[model samples]
Target chain A: MTTTSTAPLGDITGSEAALRGFLAGLPGVDQVGAEARAAMLASRSVKTSAKSYAVDLAISMIDLTTLEGADTAGKVRALAAKALRPDPSDPGCPSVAAVCVYPDLAGTARAALGNSTGHSRVQVASVATAFPSGRASLETKLRDTAEAVAAGADEIDMVIDRGAFLSGHEGRVLDEIVAVKQACRGPGAGRGGEVHLKVILETGELGTYDNVRRASWLAMLAGADFIKTSTGKVQPAATLPVTLVMLEAVRDFRAATGRQVGVKAAGGIRASKDAVRYLVMVNEVTGGDWLDPRWFRFGASGLLNDLLLQRQKLATGHYSGPDHVTLD
Target chain B: MTADRPGDRLTVRKTFKLYIGGAFPRSESGRSFVVRDAEGRFWANAAQASRKDARDAVVAARTAQPGWAARAPYLRGQVLYRVAEVLEGRKAQFAAEVGRGEGLAAPRAEEVVDAAIDRWVWYAGWADKVGQVLGGANPVAGPYFNLSTPEPTGVVAVVAPQESSLLGLVSVVAPVVATGNTVVVIASERVPLPAVTLAEVLATSDVPGGVVNLLTGRVAEIAPWLASHLDVDALDLTGAGGADSDEPTGQLAGELEAAAAENLKRVRRPPVVPEDWTADPGMDRLRWTLEIKTVWHPVGV
Candidate 1:
């Protein structure tokens, strides 16, 4: 059966008018009915259970702000140590997906992870283009992206110039994005050396749901492998509402263009519950494909401990404070 | 089947104009564009609103916000409901216009027009009640009593939807005003005639001046101005989709969102599908309209 392209307005008019008239006559401030209340409660429970299971069963970490001043060698060694040491008792203690560090530290991370015995699982990602505050020139940004990828960074996180964007310089932003993506393309040794580019929206600075949606689409159209929320430098980074808005944008973009792009809610996400909420949003908004560590990674410094605590709570039927969990 | 019966036959047409401060006016630029039927017949010449026209509309919406928002909720609902009444009276004209422009059957066009008008009436009732539903006292662990209520976010710049021209424009404008915010709407570029007629209805109805202003022009030309306009408090780009492959709408949305950030202007992205119009209103509208107002009174009193 073919779907009708045109709907006759007259046919729907009677129903529309009756509905409108009824709505018009009714009191504006009526209480929500019991059915709706019950449905809301059930949905809330479903959402919470869905989120908890997602966080407990499968969720990975992407530690971006960890290798602050560390050199390439130190960062790689750190990543190798983390990747090789998964807890034996906890089935949920999967190794992290990647270790995100500064561009200069990409080679060290790559070599450490690649050469370590029984530790080729972790990928090395690099932040390029005057990250945290993307105020650099396009040429320098492009160069930064190329240098990082050439140095064995599998993924590149580039920040959009919030100042330029706010100034209504859309063409410039698009051009920068295109140039960086072009720089990251190439052929690797056995497989393609094509680096996944995560466009950092720095949503805290963008300030509104509308802007977040717009930026999410723009990045996706400009060839973003993943759309990231924040650089984690500023306050109010990575909010649930903001992530919800971005995920909606991804879903909309996919529906519009048939392209499935990933989302990364980085920065200010420190708790297992917060991670669970992000996971819930991703699952609900984009579905199960995004539930994996390969697609979704929490850019966090203190998130692992919280995840461990939640896991412990689930196992022992008792909640434990931060003191009981081990530190990295 | 009746021969020589002129009474059985019908003709439909529309006239498009710019709506400003509750008045229907031709574009200040004195430019007009012809909208044609699917058979390539001339239907109407719509006002080609200019940058100056957009800025002027913004001025009108800004000037009228405080008073319109201050009006009693029930009174505001009554006025908005009156708009629906006027629209219902002219439903035939809207149906005919849409039928010719969209190449749809008369009956189909009538349904679209009726749905659009009814959408206005629905939101009109929401004018007063949306506040009570979306906002309330926050459960804070503090001594200070805090109540959050919905408030107009001031003048908004809106880009009406392209495909469902009249319905899309009404769907956006009604919600913005239902919560007391004034708007400057940029009508659909390809089919703008119905928007102007709706503006006429608003003028005749008791809609406060500048509560809603309509612009008819190239969205690309006018959108940047509205997005970058420093005075505008929020933007709704629900109609930025074009036939072009580049999707300039997304780029425009980003630019405007970033620009709005300077003053923390609320922004609502364009809906991907027309169904989004009838779907549950996202938090975007609520977030934009609701404000955290902390009322203080002497506890002793």
Candidate 2:
């Protein structure tokens, strides 16, 4: 079931008390069970035609990311072009879903994709709300999202304030996500349609599986169109168990509330095999409904090249080398 | 001696495992094959390394290459020399393995063992001196001073000579590592006992764990993966085209050389004829595993 439009998740965010109670009342994730299940699913092999199909799906679902301090406009433009034509040699290769960058580079990425949009072109996703570390004030964070949205960013990835959440101020975190979500609405409604809001939990810093689950529900309840695992700036980013917990949260959230939210696993997902494992996890955990690029994505840079390499290996019946793929 | 000892005690047999990252690990595939001496007597079980094992060894070698290459040439020399010393101490065991695995007479096996140890020492001596011989300053007409130095070419995948297990394995491996290149060596399929024994010596010596990874399996099964691996910088096809190889020579070597062409890997084609291990292995292999880097610096007033 694709989400045609965002619907508010009841009145859970009506007040600080309601939001806290709802998040706290939400079931605690079983750490051991989650980890064991994640490990077990990771062993499931998707091969041959299934592997080829999974590679294409994974490539199309990638939010080709470049969020480095050293990233220049030219670099973002090149990355955008690379995203559009992943394998320049293979015209049949599908473009990635989006090109993720900093707020300032959203226009560059959008322009680099040329005139194509919707069906033919890649979407531009920008990491806003003082990304990596959501340490800025609410005003600045909202400004960050608005600027990116104004810069032609079709999607806004905003990092949650882990400090506020971990410090027992869940309401403040919810308010901040709501503010960022509102800012994702661009200067006026329907100008370029609704800018998708991806709430990044930076789950690495969230501490435990239970916290990851709570954070997932909190973002979803606060109108997050997508719940992301990490900012790729912290250690232990986007672990399988954490992702499993997030995926379970989304499944339950969708069932409970009638609204479907996407899941994005970022950081440390490099190998094609790992990407396939994530795909398998998606298929098994949430069923085939979330298998589409609209529902699941990988926020990565090196992963695209690996998927390309594996795709080539499958096509050529021999192992391929890094030389065949472009360097990110 | 205890006359009352309960029957004869059961002698313990060492489980030969693949040496990777300085640790003995069974094949990731959890497969082991029976190893029989050349006389057709069952000897022991050697790990039947899979492509995954070969890939892991490449990762280990790639990880160790930088630190091993960055070591002072004198330090690398001392480490390799120490390997020779360790091999000398374990010569009896290695010679026994060689005698059985290669169907050689005890004396001939001992001679092969001696030659292998000597070859290691020879390469150890070259570790410090090879750089001086291979690198030097170039006279330039411009104001810039140009100098060239030979650097290790990262990870090397070596197929050890299938016939001459000990001497041939050492011959190919020593030259590659002598120039600071870390190697993932596929030992002779028919005679892998001595290669595993040499891995023991490498483990005990000051040589880093990943500097020399030994894999005991079919060259056809492992060499293709290593040759095409993006991380592996070179391939030595010595064992692929050996005289006693199970696969037809040139077929395997040709395939590997072509796969290596994907990344333009520095490949040393196998010898046209089976090599005489006792003969000196000249600078060919050392040069094969090294890249010449030239640098220019402005001459200051």
Candidate 3:
């Protein structure tokens, strides 16, 4: 038996009114099936060479994030340097995909990564759209997104207004996403102004697999480059089932429209094994297309250390600790 | 999937888990390794604690340190004595398990378990007097009363002996916790049953949760993590090079020592002399696990 992808996402809901019908008409998610599929994928054994490869790949996909209230420029610079060189003792550990921070610190992170040794491959990703809690107005969320993009963030992570999405307001969610995606253009829209937009559904608040599916389609149809699982602010931020639901959404979306979107399983994934499990799910659900940093990312802070530690163990036959890797 | 199917009585199996923060939790990594009997048969699947488990243990130990250290020394002694009392009651079980794990005769295993319980009793008595013995007033050429005393050094990581699974495990764990330091112990890999049973004794005793976290897995896999853990104040390398006695285990000990250097963890090496486990351990066991803090007060006219 073959698994069925979501219906071909051809601009059926291109209009505000038409999109609601399209979203409502889309197939509902079977929560048990999604959860069971995620659990089975998580149990997939990845060892030795495969583990080492997954470790490196997971490290590269990490958006080394620090969203604390006590964040300092010094802290952001240190973290950006860590993203550039995760393991100082071993030079071979690859640089992370990006350094995620609040919108205000985007430029500093960009500058720090730019000044890193050799040419820097790390991108500066900023959380915008009123961030963790999307309680603000559309004007406020747009300004936040525009500021992050203008401040040199290569990517913007925007949180949807759960208040609207939960209240059965799919059109409201779509409008916000479209506006944020437009704001991501950063003073130059379409004319080489390409700032990727990662729409954070904050699945923990969305509350169900069906909601997660709706949110994914809502974000995709409106022009999001990536569909992220959480904002790391709320409880139950990221889970296997939620990421699985999102991965399936992205997979089915790409199947429907020829445009490939990314999926990030962020928050609470602190260990190498957990991250590897997410990678396993990504492989089985999204296939090879979403395997790289461009198509998949981890929005985490402390997870990089474990990945580096495991990487060290694979290399030296002994596990490493915080002193050997970045504290973040 | 029973070995003997037709109308055979099934045996009850044991779940080997990690003792962390006073709770029995499986390793967060959910990884387990097959621990075998000395005869090379699958005995049980023991939790293979990952680096994250070591980190969580350090966190648990750190969180438990202040309160456990602040408890009255006499009361601390009582709690430790409680551990011994609990162990005494469960002696036969530990003896049987340790015997099976170490491939030892039942009589010798019983003797080892007895020694382990007695070691706890020894440390229990030392809890109250340790300060008076290790601390004293220092005379200086100043008009000030200066006193130096030994305080529990935060969290400690101990590797229990590979061969002396029970007695050696207790010997290292008892003194460290007796002086008020919380410990994260890695029991003998193939013989973690006894150590886990000890954790149970500790939980039911007055010992607080997070006071002693026990992990059963490869020292090579988890020891370096404990060594470099910033919150871990010291490391007992007593079980560093265990029964395997290979070149890699020695190099692992060296690597653990090197990793401990960054945090400046007071590293304890195995005894220079082959001392008997049954022999009474002097203050030497408790000495390195303490920190000497000196405070001075002005003499009033």
Candidate 4:
């Protein structure tokens, strides 16, 4: 005797049509040409919340590329020292979110950040999952994630297997993502040790807007706390158009699942204008709710100076020399 | 051009069948619908594609993807160029079809046809050069050599533009196939005769069987299936619904977005204003056709 299963098949899921209808009716799609211009003008005069704007103003210094010498740990300590010092006159100066370093130096950076003047405010982020290039086996990647978390890193930046994703082995990529996320989970919800997982799609690698959309969804479905643009090791690493695509993915995912995901535009983000554009994109696509530093971050080493310059220009009404403010 | 005489009779120069899996066949549902010209006269009876036709087109596109992607870029360029050549030869036929369907003057219709052919040639040149401009070496900090390159995403489903039938169809399909991704294009429901004729050109242009499958049907019926198709990696809503009608365009865009949510299909939202067929090609096509691939080898190597 054969047992017949009475489950629905194909695209007959109950909520499919409704969800499609909701997406089609989204405020952005319905409004034609004039709506975009009107929205832009409306945003210009609107006052952003000061507390939220402060977070948006926070920038994270990533020192992954500085781990070149044999004394990698010592270099991390020195970098942490520089990142933690306070500017006397500007005590109200907003602090950087974290100093991102390699996995090996996570502990050292954590200790330095813990003891520095701004110890309580700074976080220590570590790169894991055979980072910069995720060519390792799934088991190896998971081990790497667990090891980084064990080393006291607050956040883990991991790279996804672009090859597997491009080759349509989406299942394999998703599986690896789930396993690594499992590794990040602990005994207690918040106490077991909370580590955020930033899944880097490296948009530069996923060539088209469409592929970027697919990869972004895949990463989110697999449980990424944040979706990042690039590893900062590729050309076309971060661009307004590519970031716009990812932002749309994030927006759609949230609408579909009612889950909020973070976006990080990394790699070649060097100037303030680029950061502002990314901010605009996030605000426009995901709504104003995700504009804070907790939801949006710029992974850069050089952007601080430009942001400082722009901030000074806003404050003193005069351009200051690069020497006027020591970002280091 | 003929005079606008009150006694002039509407005549159909061609009737079209569904092009699926590199073969022309009647709709599985055996359905046909009469498409009328601007004068409210029936011009032709075109295939009323069924859900099965949509699936069949998906199958054809999926089957053709590997070979097409693996072909030399220059060879792909040549095949696309050949499509333009065939389209140029039948310029008058397409112009006449557009004239009746869109209510454009004869000269204006011919110009639209010429513009469509020119659009194909422009995309043909991009087949070889897009990769160089879009993908390249990355400067990694460690002792590892890394490079990023673009590759074709597999099978795409396109909802061709309703207003500019031939040009819109070519604009959507050329970019997709130019980058080695196979396509299943849903022709304009109001004007599908030209879409079927273009399929004939694709068949003879060495585009390979199944590379570009053309289906003539109601987009509302077929778009949801294509959008939600698990095997279909990307869906383009470039030309579906009337741009003038917010109700239908919004409804279609939302349905496609939600269906695409299942597999997270990449969706190119329809443009508010139809793209100019004769204008220089923008990054819109390249943005939709490519995927990023990051490669790593040991530092010293």
Q: In angstroms, give how far residue B153 of model 3 lies from its true place.
A: 5.7
Q: List, residue by residue over B106-217, the lDDT tens digit for candidate 4.
A: 9998988888888889989889887887888888988877888889988898988887788778888889989999999889878788889889888777789999999998
Residue range A1-328, candidate 3, lDDT tens digits: 1144456556555666676777677678887888888889888989999999999999989999999989999999999878888888778889999999999999899899883433346888999988889999899989888888878888899998899888878888888888888788758333235889999999988877878888898898889999999999888988998888888888877777788999988889998899999999888888988999999999999898888878877896544445566554
lDDT (10s digit) by residue, model 1, range B1-301? 6647767665554457788887778888899888767688876788888877886787788789889989988899999999999999999989987887767898889888888887888888887787677777766665656677677778888888776678777877888887888899988777777787788889888998899898888887788777766668788876764332126447766775676665566777755544445545444553565565656433343
lDDT of 2: 0.88
Evaluate model 1: give its lDDT.
0.71
Model 1 regions more than 4 Å off: A1-328, B1-15, B242-249, B273-287, B296-298
DockQ of each: 0.01, 0.43, 0.22, 0.01
Q: Which stretches of candidate 2 lie over 4 Å from their true place?
A: A1-9, A188-191, B1-11, B105-107, B138-148, B227-232, B242-250, B258-267, B293-301
Local accuracy of candidate 2 as per-residue lDDT tens digits, A189-275: 254589999999998888888798889988998899999999998988888888888888888887778789999999999998999
Q: lDDT for model 3, please.
A: 0.85
* Candidate with maximal lDDT: 2
Interface RMSD of each: 23.9, 2.7, 4.4, 25.9
Q: List A-chain TM-scores for all predictions.
A: 0.77, 0.95, 0.94, 0.77
- The full ranking of all candidates by lDDT, starting with the best, is 2, 3, 4, 1
Ranking by DockQ: 2, 3, 4, 1
Off by over 4 Å in 4: A1-328, B1-13, B241-249
